[model samples]
Structures are given as structure tokens and as C-alpha cells.
Target: MHVPDGFINAPVSVAAGVVAAGAVAVSLRGARRELDEATAPLAGLVAAFIFAVQMLNFPVAAGTSGHLLGGALAAILVGPYTGVLCISVVLLMQGILFADGGLTALGVNITVMGVVTVVVAYALFRGLVKVLPRKRGSVTVASFAAALISVPAAACVFTAIYAIGGTTDVPVGKVLTAMVGVHVLIGIGEAVITMLTVGAVVAVRPDLVYGARGLAAPLKLRVGGELVDAPAARPVPVAARSPRAVWATGLVTALVLAGFVSFYASASPDGLEKVAADKGIDKNVEEHAAKDSPLADYGVKDITDARISGGLAGVIGVGVTVVAGTGIFWSVRRRRTTDAAPTHVPESV
Candidate 1:
């Protein structure tokens, strides 16, 4: 949920901003270990894909809709640290470019949506994968459960934050109940989307899916009625097993989803918006600072055709987000390489 400005007071919002800043800082360091030559670029595409899928909000209740939060999907595909960065990038883009989330409340949004979701989902996913059968299918199953749980977990976090700094005097219990209830329905959609996306990636390139790595059991061969461990398989050549194909396919899919499919997304308000309106949480909500931007509200300024305007905005968002995310991840990957490089010391002459 994109928390608009004025929903939280200045002091609490600033405190949340510090917390968000610290999280991003820690994740940046952790991401150094997660990013690699193949994954660094792939991570960018994942961010873009999440940005696109989030546009296709599905109906959750009579007046509430939900979209992919992308934390579990990202963590499963890449890693948790990188997943947090991915969501942060998407949230930053949406707030500044689309005027969807509040600039002032950016920290609150990141803490609740990016940090909390990624941490909770990834931790649960790891636990489930450990106990479940170590098969590809198990990863997908775990992804579904993790994603389903993450949504409500995020809702609870938001409720807690609101309880502390909510602008209105609404009953905290009521807010918690409504928020958790609607988000539970939303979580199912999140689970399905995460499961399908993770399954698809794991099928095509398990190596690219961080959670699926090391999941395949050693090959066994029957030798005169006795099963023995098979010889180790040779590593595939880098050229022969490139991630370009997967990257291109993912980018194309993202383009299709955001550029065209988003037109059919439910027009109803999302879970948070619905809850806020119902509970008077928006009584003090302020207008977005970027509301006048050309691409504000996911539409191009002065574009009469709704389809064309929205399509252009979506395409632009995908392009910008991919570029920005790739740059950040590639830099992180480079830093990791530098850190791992051997340093030489000259002998005393």
C-alpha cells in the first residue's frame, strides 16, 4: 500500500525515514554478496517486472483490489537483500514519477512494504524450504505460502505504524481487523502470482532463482541392480548457457503486461485505500507533491486517449526503472568483485 502524505505526523514520519534509511544501507552491503554477473542484470529486470505486474490490480473484495507486493517473488528469484532494494526502487519510482505514493511518507512506505515484507517472506520461505521436500515444486509451494503470509504481515506492520502515528482518532483495533481481513484476500492473489513467477523461472533457469539453487538431488545410476552416485556433470560453457534469452523474454513479458494488460486492471481502490477511506484515515491526507508531473497518476499529460497515455506512462516507467536498477546492481556487483580481488604487496627492496 502506498501511504500518502499527512497520514503520519512529522516526528513519526521522520523516525520511520531514519529506519528506512538504515535498512537500505544495510541491504546495500548485503546485496554485495548476492549480486553476480548474471544476477546483477537479472535483478534489474526483476524490478521492472514487479513494477509492471503491480499495475494489474486484481479485485479482492467488493470495493478493494490488490496487486503484487513483489517481496517474496524477488527474494525467491534473487535474494532478500536485493529483493528489498528492488521493492525500494519500484516504490521510489512510483512515488516520484507516478505520484502514487507520498514523497513525505516514503520512509513509512519502504519500512512497511519493502523491509518488512522481504524480511518476513524470505525468512518463512527459507524455513519452509528446509522442512519441505528439496524439490523444485517445494520451492514453488513455499513461495506461495511465504507470499500469502507476507501480505498480512505487511498489513500488521502498517497497522502498528498507524497505531503509533495515525493522524485520525480511529480505533486501532478496527483498523487492524479491516486491514488484516482485506489483505488476507489480497495475499492469495500475491501467493498465486509469486508461485507462478517463481515456478516459471525455476523451470527455465534454476540457477537464476536464488532459492532453487542446490535443490537438485545428486544423479543416481542403477549398476547391476544397485544404485550408485553418477559422475559429476561438466559445467556448461558460459556462451552456451547465457541468461540473455531469459532476460529478453522477461523484459518482453513485462512490457506486454504493463503496456497493454494493465488496461484491464480493476479500477477499484486497493486494500489500503479502501481501508483508509472507510476508517477516515484519509481525513488529513495531503496531495502528492508530484501530482502535476506529466506522468502523474500513470497517465501522460494532455493525452486525450486513456489507453495511449497510460500505455506510454507504463512503458516509460519500465524503461527508467530498469535502467536505474541495473546501474545500481551492476555497481554493487562491481564492488563485490573489487572486494574479492587479491591485493598485492611489494617486498622490501
Candidate 2:
């Protein structure tokens, strides 16, 4: 959920900012180990896809709706470190461009939504995949559970943050209960979306799915009435194959979802907004600093047609996020290459 400005006090918000910055720094380093020529573009696509799916909020309860938090999906498709970067980039774009999340509370949102979700979900996903059958279906199953748990974990983290720095006088108990209750329902939506997306990719090309990698069992051969491991097959370099088909398909899907399908998404408030309004958590809510921006609230300033304005904004958001994310990831990939290159020393003449 997007935490708006004034929900948390200045001191704690600043503290969270420091924590967020440190986590991002760590992730940047870790991502170097994860990204490559192929997966780097995939990571950028994951960010744009997350941004698009978030616009299609599905009804969760009477008046509450839920959207994909995307940590599990991203972590499964890419890697956890890159997944954190993916969600963080989406939140950054939404905050500065769409004026959706709060600028002041950016750290809080990143900590709860980006860091907490990725850590909890990826850890659980790894554990489950180890115990379950090492098959493609098992990865998808583990993804479901990981996604299901991550949402509530994030809710608990937000509750704790609010207890420490909430501006209102509301009881912490009520806030926790409401946040957990609604988010639990919301988690189902997250799980399904994560499951389907991961399954689809795993089905098409298991090589592309980070979590599904190495799941292919070694070939076996029967010789002299005994079974033994077959000779290792020559592996193809990741850089040799083209990822253009998958990348183009994913981009087109994101474009369609944002530009056409989002119009039918539920208009009701999301899980966090509903809980906040019900629990008086928004009593001290402040207006967004970018509220007057032309693209504020996911609509163009001069475009009067609701459909056209929202579609254009969504398209623009997808484009910008893809470009920014790709730039960042490609740079990281290049850095990885630079770090991995062997240095030469001249012999004494």
C-alpha cells in the first residue's frame, strides 16, 4: 500500500529514509551478481509489468480493493535483489510522476512494500522450492505461497511503523487488526496474479525464470541394467540466444493492460486506503506535493475524456518506467561486466 505524507512523523520518516537508502545501496551491489545481458532487460520489463498490473485493482471486500504488490512475482521471475529495485523504481515513478504515493513517506513505502516483501517472500519461496518436488509446477506453487504471505508481512510491518510514528491518536490494536484483516483478503489477489504470471513464463521458457532455473533434472541413462547419470550436455551461452520475442510479448501485454484493460478496474479504495479511512489514520493526511502536476492522479491535465486521459497516462507511465528501469539495469549489467573482467599486469621490462 502507498503511504501518504504526514502519516508518519518527521523523525521516524527520516530514520526510515536512512534505512531505505542503505537497503537500496546493498541491493545495487547484489544486483550486479544477478543481472546480465538477457536478465537485465527482463528486470526492466518486470518493473513496467508491475506498474501496469497495479493499475488494475480487483475487488477484495465490500468496499476494499487490492492490486499486485509484485515482490514475489518479480523475485521469482528475476532475482530478489533486482526485484527490490523493480518495485522501488515503480514506487518512485508513481510518486513523482503520478502523485500517487507520498514524497515525504517514500522511505516508509519502500521499506514496507519493497524491502520487507522481497525479503520475506524470497526467503519463503526458496525454502518451499527446496522441500517441494523440483518441477516447474512446484515453483509456481511456491510462488503462490510466497506471494500470499508477503502481503500480510508487509501489513504487519506497516502496522509496526504506524505504532511508532502514527500522527493520530488511534489505538494501535485497531489499526493492526483492520490492516491485517483486509490485507489477508488482498493477499489472495496477489497470490493468484503471481501464480499465473510465473506459470505463464515458466511454461514458455523456464530458462528465463530465475526461480525455475536448475529445476531440470540431469538426464539419466541405463547401461548394463543399471541407471546412471548421462554425460553433461553442452550449455548454450545466455548471450547467444535472442530474448526479443519474450521481451516484445511482455511489453505488448503491459501496454494492453495499462492502455485498454485498466479502464474496467474497480474504482473502490484499495486495502490500505480503506483501512486508513475506517481507523481514522488519515486524520492528519497532507496533500501530495505533486498533486498539481499535469499527470497527477493518473490523468492528463487537459484531456477531459476519462478513458483517453487515464489510458494516455498509463501508457506514458509504462513507457517512462521501462526506459528508466532499463537504463538503470543496463548500467548495472555493464558494471557487472567491468567488475568480472580480468585485470592484466605488465611484466617488468
Candidate 3:
């Protein structure tokens, strides 16, 4: 959920900002270990995809809706460190460009939606995968469960933050109950979406899925009625076309989802919005700083056609996020490569 300004007092908000900044710094370092040539570009695509899917909010209750928080999906597809960065980029873009989240509450949103969700989901996902059967299906199952839990975990974190710094007088217990209850329902939708997306990627390119790596069992052979490890197979040549094919397909899918399908998303308020209203969390909410931006509220300024305006905004968001994310990831990957390169010692002679 995107926290707006004034919901949390200045002291707590600034503290969260510091925490968020530190987390991002740590993630950047961790991501260097996670990203390589093959996966670096994919990381950017993962962010864009998450941005697109989040636009299609599905109805959770009579008046409440939910969208993909995308922690599990991104972590399963990429890696946790990169996943945190991915969601953070989306939150930043939405806050500054679309005014969907408040600038002052950026840290709160990043902490709850990016750091907490990614950390919790990835931890649970790894645990589940370790105990379950090491099959592709198991990864999907783990993904679903991880996503299901992450939403409520984020809600609990938000509740705790509110307890410390909430501007309203609402009881902390009541706020926690309502936030967790609605988010649980929202978590179901998150689980399904994560399962399907992770399953699809694992099916097409398990190598690209960071969580699925090393899950494949070694080849076995039966010799003299005893099973023994098979000889290592010869490396198969990757067609020059495969990588481009997958990238093209994924980018196209993201474009379609954001540009065409988002128009059909439920218009009702999302889980956090609904809970805030019912629990009085919005009593002190302030207007977004970017509220007057041309692309504010996911619509083009002076655009009368709701469909066209929203579609253009969505498309623009996807493009910008992809470019920004790719630039960040590619630079990280390059730096990692440079660091790993051999350094020559000269002048000893």
C-alpha cells in the first residue's frame, strides 16, 4: 500500500526515510552479486512487468480492491535484492510522475511495500522450497505461499508504524485488525498472480528465474542395477534468437497489460484506501506534491477521454520505468564486471 503524506508524523517519517535510504544502499551492493549479463536486462523487465500488473486492480471485497504488490513475483523471477530495487523504482515513479503515492511518504511506502515485502517473501519462499519437492511446480507453490504472507506482513508493519506515528486517534488494535483482515483477502489475489507469473517464467526460461536456479537435480543413470550420476552432458548451443525472443515477448506482454487491459481494472479503492477510510487513517492525509503534474493520477492533462488518457499514462509509465530500471541495473552489472576483471601490477621490473 502507498502511504500518503501526513499519515505519519514528521519524526517517524524522517526515521523511515533514513531506514529506506540505508536499505536501498545495501540492496545496491547486494544486487551486484545477483546481476550478471544474462539476468541484468531481465531485472529491468521484471520491474516494468510489476509496474504494469499493479495497474490492474482486482476486486477483493464488495468495495475494496487489490493489486499485485509484486515482491514475491519479482524475487522469484529475479533475486531479492534486485526485487527490492525493482519495487522501489516503481514506487518512486508512481510518486513523482503519477502522484499515486505521496512524496513525503515515499520512505514509508518504500519500507512497507518494497523492503519488508521482499525480505519476508523471499525468506519464506526459500524455506518452503527447501522442504518441498524440488520440482518446477514446487517453486510456483512456494511463490504463491510467499506472496500470500508478504501482504499481511506489510500490513502489520504499517500498523506498527502507525501506532508509533499515526496522526489520527484511532485505536492501534482496531487499525491492526482491519488492516490485516482486508490485506489477507488482498493477499489471495497476490498469491494467484505470483503463482501464474512465476510458473510462466519458469516454464519458458528457468535459467532466468533466480529462485529456480540450482533447483534442478543432477542427471542420474542406472548401471548394474544401481543408480549413479550421469556424465556431464555436452553444452548445448543457445540459438542467437532465444534471448531476444523471450525479451520481446515479455516486453510486449507488459505493454498489452498496461496499455489495454488496465482500462478494465476495478475503479473501487484498493485495500489500503478502503482500510484508511474505515479506520480513520486518512483523517490527516495531505495532498500529493505532484498532484498538478501533467501525468498526475495516471491521466494526461486536459485529456477528456478517460480511456485514452489512462492508456497513454500507463504506456508512458511502462516505458520510463523500463528505461530507468534498465539503466540502473546495467550500470550495476557493468561495475560488477569491472570489479571482477584482473588487475595488473606493473613497475616491479
- Cα-based TM-score, every candidate: 0.98, 0.98, 0.98
The residue-by-residue lDDT of candidate 2 on 97-177, one tens digit each, is: 999989999999999999999999999999999999878999999999999999999999999999999999999999999
Tens digit of per-residue lDDT, candidate 1, span 44-109: 999999999999999999978999899989988999999999999999999999998899999999
**Candidate 1 lDDT for residue 164:** 95
lDDT of 2: 0.93
lDDT of 3: 0.91
Error of 3 at 278 (Å): 1.1
RMSD of each: 1.1, 1.0, 1.2
Question: After superposition, which runs of candidate 3 have C-alpha atoms over 4 Å from their true positions?
Answer: 237-242
lDDT of 3 by residue, 164-209 (tens): 9999999999999999999999999999999998998889888788
Clashing pairs in 1: none
lDDT (Cα atoms) of all candidates against the true structure: 0.94, 0.93, 0.91
Note the clash tally of each candidate: 0, 0, 0
Task: Pick out the ten consecutive residues of candidate 3 with the lowest summed lDDT.
Answer: 235-244
